[model samples]
Target: MSATTLLLVTLGLALASFAYGRSRAYSVARLGGGVRSMHSLPSHYGMMVALWCALPALAIIVGWKLFEPSVVSGFLQDYIPQSVYEAGEKSVELYKNDIGNLVDSQAIADIQDPDKKIAAQQLASMRHISSLALFVLALAAAIAGATLALKRIKADTRARHNVEKIVQFFLISCASIAILTTLGIVLSVLFESLRFFQEVSIIEFITGTTWSPQTAIRADQVGSSGSFGAVPLFLGTMLISFIAMVVAVPFGLMSAIYLAEYASRPVRSICKPLLEILAGIPTVVYGFFAALTVAPALRSFGATLGLSVSSESALAAGAVMGIMIIPFVSSLSDDVITAVPQSMRDGSYGLGATKSETIRKVVIPAALPGIVGGVLLAVSRAIGETMIVVMAAGLAANLTANPLEAVTTVTVQIVTLLTGDQEFDSAKTLAAFALGLMLFVVTLCLNVIALHVVRKYREQYE
Candidate 1:
C-alpha cells in the first residue's frame, strides 16, 4: 500500500480507538457511581488512546517514507549489468534514472531488451511487496499502541498529564525545525562565501570602486580579467534605500497618525483597506508602472523644471518602491498608535493640552517603540524588493550619491551573477553567495535594532 492509503487506514483505527476508550472509561466510572471516580474526564482518556494509536503508526509510516527511495535504489544494484555498474558516479546516477523511466513508461511489451524488461518486472514486484509489508506493520503498531493505552486506562491514570507532555514535545519539535533551518542557511552561505574569498581578495571586493566580475577562461585570455569591487553596488543600494525611506516614513507615519487619531470610523474603515490594497498588487505590476509611467513622468517633470534626471534614475525607483512599502509602514504604525491607552489621551485633555499636542507628546512617545519596529520592517521590505528596482533603476553600477543618476543595487548584481548558463566554479558565480552573506548581515542588524527598540519601550509601558 502507498503511504497515503496506510495513513488513512491508521487514522480510521485511531478514531475507532478513541470511541472505544471513551466508552470503556464511562463504564468504569459508572461502576464507582459517577465520573468523579476517574482521575481525568472520559474525553481525556479518549484523547490519550487516540494519541497512542496515531503517533506510533505515523512515526513508522514517516520513517518508511523517508527511507523508501534509498532502500529501493539499493535493491536495484543487484539488477545492474557489470559494465554499467563499474562506471563513475554520474553514470550510476543516470542508470538509476533510466530504471525509474523504464518502470514508468515501458511495459514488458514496450521493452525491446529482454533483460531490462525482466529486471523492471522484478523491481515492480519487490516494491509492491515492500509497500504491503509497511502497510501491515503500521496497522499492527497502531493496534498494539491502542490496546496498551486502553488496558492502562483506570481511576489512577494521568491521561491529562500524558496528553500535555505529547503536545509539548510537538511544539518543541516545530521550534527546533525553524531554528535548525536558519542555522543551515547561515552555514551554507558562509561556506560558499569562504570559497569565493579564496578566489578573490576580500579587501579588493569590499574597497575597490569598479564592479566588473568577469574571470578569464585562460590565464592569457584578454578582457576577461575582472575587478571585484563592491563599493559602487553598496553605495547605489544605500542611495536608493535612503530615497525610499525619505518618501515612505513621513507619508506612511503621517497617514497612520491621521487614520488612527483623527479620521471618523466610517472613513477609517473604507480608506484603510483601500490603502492596503496597494500591498496586494504584484511587484511586477509596480515594475511596469515604475518603468513605463513613473520614469517617463519624472524625466518630463525634470525637463520642465530645467533639471537633468536620467531616463532610469534612482529617484524614480525609490519613489515607486516607497509607494509599494507604504502599507507596510501605515498598517503597522496605525495598529501601534490605536493600541495606545485612551486614558492617556483623556489625561492630556484634562491638562489643557490640544489634540495635536497630546499626540505629539503623550501618544506618540507611548507608541514609539512599535512605530519604530514597523518602520524597520518597512525598510527591510524596501531593501529586499527586486522587481521595482530592476525596472525603474537601470543596471549601471554607477558610484553616485545623486538620486537623479542611474545606479544598480547589490540585489541586481546578485541576480546578474546567478542568471544565465554560467559555470558555478568561477569567482563570478561565487560572488553571488558572498553578496547574499553581506545582505543577510545587513538585514540581521535591522532586525536586532527593531527588537531592541520594541523590548526597551515595552518594558516601560507594560
Candidate 2:
C-alpha cells in the first residue's frame, strides 16, 4: 500500500477511537450524575483512552517502517550470486541500489539477468504481503484496545488518575528526549575526536604552540608538520570574556539600580525596554560594528598612545561582547533587586541611613547572590559566543597578554577547524570536539557554583 493510504488509515483509526472514548466517558458521567462525583473531568478520561489506543500502535508501526528495509536488505545480501557480491564493495552497492529500484517499481528490467530478475520479483511480492499483514494486525490491535478501554469505563473507574499519569509520563519522556539528544551530540563529537586521536597523539595536538591546520596530503609534500597548540586560543577566549565582563557588569548593574530603585514610573517604563532594544539587535550587526567601527577607532587611539596595536585587536571584540551582555546582566539584576522586600529598605532608612547607604549596604548585598548568578550566566554566554569574535578578532593564534595584539579565541578555532571540506578523522576536525567538550565542562561547573552561591545567600535573606 501507498504511504498516503497508510497515513489515512491510521488517522481514521485514531479519530474513531477518540469518538468511542468520548462516548464511554459521557456514559460514566451520566451514571455518576452529580458534581464533585469524579476524581477529574470526563474529557480527560476520554483523552486518556484515545492516547493509549493510538500511541503504542503508532510507535510499533514507525519502528517497523524504520527497520524493515535494513533487515530485508541484509537478508537479501546472502541470496545474491557470490561473483556479484565479491566484485568490489562499490559494485555490490550498485547491485543493491538496482534491486531496491526494481522492487519499488515492481518491474524487473534493471535486474538484466533472468535469475536475478525472478528473485527480485519474488522478494518484492513477499515484502508487500508482509507489510500489508503487519499494518492490518496493528490496526486491529488498536481498535480492540480502544474497545476494551471503552467497555471498562464505569462510574467508579479511576480513569482520570490514569489519564493524568499518562500525561505526566509523556512530559517526562519529552524531557528525556531533549537530554538524550544532548548526550547523542556529545557522544558523536567524542567518537570523531577519538578517530582523530588515532592519527595524531594527544600530546602533539594539545601541547604544540603553533596552529597551522593545513597538512600536506602526500608523503613527500612540504609543510606537513602542522602544529596544534590550544593554549593561545584558550587565552584569547579568557581575555575577551574578561574584558566584556568588565564593561558589562558595572554599567549594567548601575543601570539596573537606577531603573529598579530610583526611576520615576514614566522614566522606568520608557528606559527599561529602550535599553532592552540593544539585546534585540542581531549579533551580525554587532559584529560589523565591532569590525568596521570599533576596531579602527581602537587602532587609531592606540597609535596616538605610542602603542603597537593590530587593526583587529582583542580589545575591540571584547568591548563589543561586553556591550552585548550588558542587558542580560542589567535585566536580571533589576528583577532580583526589585524583588527584595521594601521593608528591608525602610528599616535601613529608619536607622538614619542615607539612600545610597541603604542601597549599597542593605539592598545590594541582598541581591548579590542573584547578581552573581546573572554574571555566571553572562560568562557562559561570552564563552560560547561566536560571530563577534569571528568578525572583529583576528584569526591568528597568539599567546599574548597585550589587549592591543590580535588573538584567536577557542570558538574561532572551532569554527575554522570545522569549516571547508574537512576529513572527519583529521586532528583539525577533532579539535573542534575537544574544544566543545572543554567549553561544556567549564559552563556546567560555573552553573553549579552559581546555583549554590545563590541558594546560600537567598537563605540569609529568608
Candidate 3:
C-alpha cells in the first residue's frame, strides 16, 4: 500500500485497539464490583493504549521517510557499474539522477546505457522491498506496544497519569518545533548575511548613498561595478512608510474614538466590520489599484496644479498603502479603547469631566500600549510591502524625500537583487541577504523602542 494509505490503516488499527482496551478495562473493573473501584476512567485506559499503539509506529514511519533516500543509495552501490562508481561526486550525482529518472519512468537527460537501465530497474525493486519491510516492522511495533499496554491495564492501573504525561510530552514537542524553527531562520539569515558582508564592506553597505547591486560578470561589462550603499533605499522606505503613517494614524485613531465612545451601537457595528474589510483585501489588488488608478490620478492632479509629479511616485503608493493599513490601526485601537475599564470613564464623569476630556486623559492613555503595538505592526507592514511600491512607486533607488519622486525600498531592492538565477557567492545575490538582515535589525530596534515606551506609559497608570 502507499505510505499515506498505510498510515491511515495504522491509525484505524489504533482506534480499534482503543475500543478493545476500553472493553478489557471495563471487564476488569466489573470483576472488582464496579467501575468506581477502578483507579482511572475507562476512557483514560483506552487513550493510553491508543497512544502506545500510534506513537512508536508513527515515529518509525517518520524516521524511515526522512532517511530512506540516503539508505537506499548506500546499498544501491552494488548495482552501479565500476566505471560509474569511479566517477567523482558530481558525476555520481548525475548517474543517480539518471537512474532515478528511469526508475520513475521519466525521460533521462541523455542517451541511457543498457547497464544503467538495468541498475535503475534493480534499484526500484530494492526500494519496493525496503518499503514492504518497513511496513511489516512498523505493524509489528504497533501490535507489540498495544499488547504491552493492554497487559498493564488493571483495576488499579494509573492510566490517566500516564496518558496525561504523554499528552504533555507532545505539547512540549510542538512548542519546541516552533522555537527551533525560529532559531533555524535566524541562523540561516545570519550565515547568509555574513557571506554577503565578506564580499561587500559593511561600512559601505550601511553609509554609502547609492544602491546599484550590479556585479561584474565580465571585465568589460558596462554599468556593472555595483554600488552596495543602502542609504537611498533606506530613505525611500522611510519616506513611504512615514507618509503612510501620517495618512493612517490620525484618521484611524479618530475613527476608533468615534466608534468606541460616540457612535450608536448599530453604526459602530456596521462601520467596524466594514473598516476591517480593508485588511482582508489582497495587497496585490491594492497594488493594481495604486498603479492603475491612484498613481494616474495623483499625476493628473499634480499637473493641473503645475507640480511635476512622476508617473510612478511614492505619494501614490504610500497613500494607497495607508488606506490598506487603516483597518489594522482602527480595529486594534477600537478594541484597546473599549478594553479601558468602564469604571474609569464613570469616575471621570463623576469628576465633572466631559466624555471628550475623559477620552483624552484617561481612555487614550489606558489603551496607549495596545495602540502603539498596532501602529508598530502597521509600520512593519509598510516597510515589508513590495507589490504596491513596485507597481505605484517605480523601482528607482533615488536618495530623495520628495513624495512626488519615484523611489524604491529595501524589500524592492532585495527582490530585485535575488529575482533570477544567481550564484550565491556573488555580491549581487548576497546583497539580498544583507538587505534582509538590515530590515530585520531595523524592525527589531523599533520593537525594542516600542517596548520601552509601552513599559514607561504602563507604569504611569500602575
Best by TM-score: 1
Candidate 2's clash total is: 1
Across residues 330-379, which tens digit of lDDT does each residue of candidate 2 receive? 99999999989999999999999999999999999999999999999999
Q: Local error of candidate 3 at 325, Å?
A: 1.3
lDDT of 3 by residue, 113-223 (tens): 877867777787878898898899889989999999999999879999999999999899999999999899878889999998988899999999988887875557665
Of candidates 3 and 2, the better by TM-score: 3
Against the hidden reference, what TM-scores do the models get?
0.95, 0.83, 0.92
Error of 3 at 221 (Å): 6.0
lDDT order, best first, reads: 1, 3, 2
- Please identify model 2 stretches exceeding 4 Å from their true place: 1-20, 35-40, 71-87, 94-141, 187-208, 217-220, 304-307
Which residue segments of model 1 deviate by more than 4 Å? 106-108, 217-223
What residue pairs are clashing in model 2? 208-229
Task: Give the worst 10-residue stretch by lDDT in candidate 2.
Answer: 34-43
Candidate 3 deviant stretches above 4 angstroms: 83-87, 106-113, 218-223, 459-462
The lDDT for every candidate, in the order shown, is 0.89, 0.83, 0.89
Better of 1 and 3 by TM-score: 1
